[model samples]
Target: MVGAEQTLEVEGHPCVVVDRAAMQYRVVTSDSAAVALERKGTSFARRLGRRRNTVTVRALHELSLVVERGESLGIIGRNGSGKSTLMRLISGQERPTTGAVFASSTPIMLGVNAALMPDLSGHQNVVLGCLAMGMSWEQVNAKFSSIVELCGLEDSIYLPMKSYSSGMASRLRFAIAASIDPEILLVDEALNTGDAQFGDRSMKRMDQLREQAGCVFLVSHSLDTVIKMCSRVIWLDKGHLIMDGDPTETVQTYRDFTGHLAKGNNISAVRIRDEARASLQMTEVLTRGKSRRSRP
Candidate 1:
């Protein structure tokens, strides 16, 4: 079954297609300390104990969505609601447990926690990061100054990454990720890390990317950011997609639901959630030689 799920790129499409995708993990429930204690007992006292129970955790549940060229899509949900998992699946970092993901090009993932060598100088890391993303050394050299400028890391680029603040690192990551002019970009909570000036610069860069017929997927908890940067938004709750539509309407509904949850009004929250789920329209997924419709 795992072999059946794959991420493939379709030539010349510049879009993303996710069909009935789901991700699950099995976790053992037994306490490791207790198991170790039992193992240390004498043979006579080591009669077979109950087997450890394994439970399946669904990180993403039958999610299906399409992102076309020039579309900036925002994904919103509470913590542990599968936002990051969905981004991984879309970016081809992880295969879905059940369905398949298809894209026109390899998606570049930029996040606040993007991995960079802490001990290396920021300048060295930028060159290495660009190289890791398949950039030629000559290309890296040509774009090196521009990348640093976009990140607004001046002489500080010579300092070790560990010496930089969280916002500085995030800016550097974003600069590197955007340097390639990726046809498909996956942004996960990275924008929230930057200050207002950097945010303006980042938005302009994203706008240019979209103008060139690219697609972007953004996962952020900030409702205002989603409403401002995305033309469409999808709301997910507990791994289920609750709503997909205009950014303003979808975000407003999600905000109302969370507000109810905060006020200890689970009943109202559930009602809003169900209503949103029921209102979601079916999404059509286009494949190489066929197309199909499914509810998200």
Candidate 2:
């Protein structure tokens, strides 16, 4: 059963491979990571053994960011700093509950639940997935050659995916997702497993994407990728936006801030105070639509 399940080994292990550049609003969403979350709920048991539950996570405060065409915006933040959450929101898999996210076109989310088929074999699944992504049968048939070529999994593309190795399965998933010429593609740390050469090839693909296609979002921990591949960056801290600027400047600031906080100084406190100030500034600027790039 090694190759029983169809899997794209090279690009299969390297899911989310295209790494295409965003041409317009590639990072068009506003850089301000403004969100208002409200966790309000009450759970109680009444006389009849009936329980009541309320809803939470209402942060209606919205920061509308427009990822301009041809821009690469990187999201940098600590774990649980709402980086993944923001990615999900941006990908349109989930609604903002209060605000609205209107992309110029549909966004393709790689890590979102749409990349795989549970019952279908990997090879069969690839064709089905591509067609489902708005591609006509002819286009799917035509691109199948290139897709399999880049994925490098001709033999394994015919087996059931449930049996494929983790790496192999990941690569196949990426190959299928990329078959579509997505206008806006969302990737969430889906490439941290591949080797160096794979990374290089993927980067090349992303460059082509930006040059030929449209915009893309890469949510990853590789600062090198962010620095080397991205033209701009956005920093998030504790669900609040820390900064939005040039990658060189912003990544540097983020690294320093991370170091300061890791060293257990007054950095967290400083950041908290800064968040408060930033909130006020957001109020002023958002209310007027004239931001001064407030900083702490």
Candidate 3:
């Protein structure tokens, strides 16, 4: 039997007919590394067996979002706030323990850990990465020079990937990922690794992606980068989405909370968090009510 369609609404924003729509990830937890090693039969030294400690860590919780074409959406949060987890979910690298994610097309994700063969030269990796992204060999050949130029890695492209610094590798990866013109591009801290000139080129390429009727989801710890590149932003804390709206306002709210918390003003920080949560709850109610009314 066919299952019912699962839908999600974000706040009270106008019903955006998303090219990609209604993505949600339920609370998912994983066992600690020690338990994982035992499961993998790596070592039996501890011999805890069935009685082993198996603590679960939740990476993401109840995240519902819609992304439309021509939109550059920024995902911002403190470290461990589930930004990368959400991107992996959207990219089909990980399945949600509950709920579902829907997108009209496959998403290309460029991460700091993007795969490249350490033994292979940067040029060879580009050819391999492009082919992996579904480009024809001819297309790879055609895009090679432009990709090299975009990465500003003209000389290093001939060297083994192992010889390149982290920043250089990140630049080459970003260039390859952007060259294919993916319908949905998920960038995870890739831009921050590049130098100023490279950053400018990458941002322009992202703009080109948006202008081509594609969507870009950027996850970065740099609030300045998020505000500058994205028209809309989502603020996540402890895996919960506190706000998803205008970039400036959302960033400001996040900044205020972090500042108070850093200053050891626990009371003020808690108050700010409570207020944001209340606002989010009210928006959820309004959005759900509207969805119900619109349904048959």
* Model 3 agreement with the true structure over 1-296: per-residue lDDT tens digits: 00112244443222122222223432323556645654575456654554635534567765566776667889988888888888878888877766667777777786556599999999999999889878999999999999999999998899999999888888888888788777777888877768999989988887777566477888988899899889899877777777778999989998999999999998998798779767877776776677789977
Give me the runs in candidate 1 sitting further than 4 Å from their true place.
1-14, 30-52, 281-296
lDDT string for model 2 (49-166, tens) is: 5222222332222343546666677888888666776676767656554444556676777652455765678778878888788898898889887667655667877778787777
Clashing pairs in 1: none
- Greater lDDT among 2 and 3 belongs to 3
Tens-digit lDDT string for candidate 1 (1-296) = 01112233333444888877899986766666644554565364443543564556789888667677888899999998999999999989899998888888888887656589999999999999999989999999999998888899999999999999988998999888778777788888867668888888887876776566488888988789889889898888889888888999999999899999999999999999998776453222233224223323
User: What's the lDDT for all of these models?
Assistant: 0.80, 0.59, 0.75
The worst-scoring run of ten residues by lDDT in candidate 1 lies at 1-10
Angstrom error of the Cα, residue 206, model 1: value is: 2.4
Task: Show pairs that collide, candidate 3.
Answer: none
Q: Give candidate 3 misplaced runs (Cα > 4 Å).
A: 1-51, 290-296
TM-score of 1: 0.81
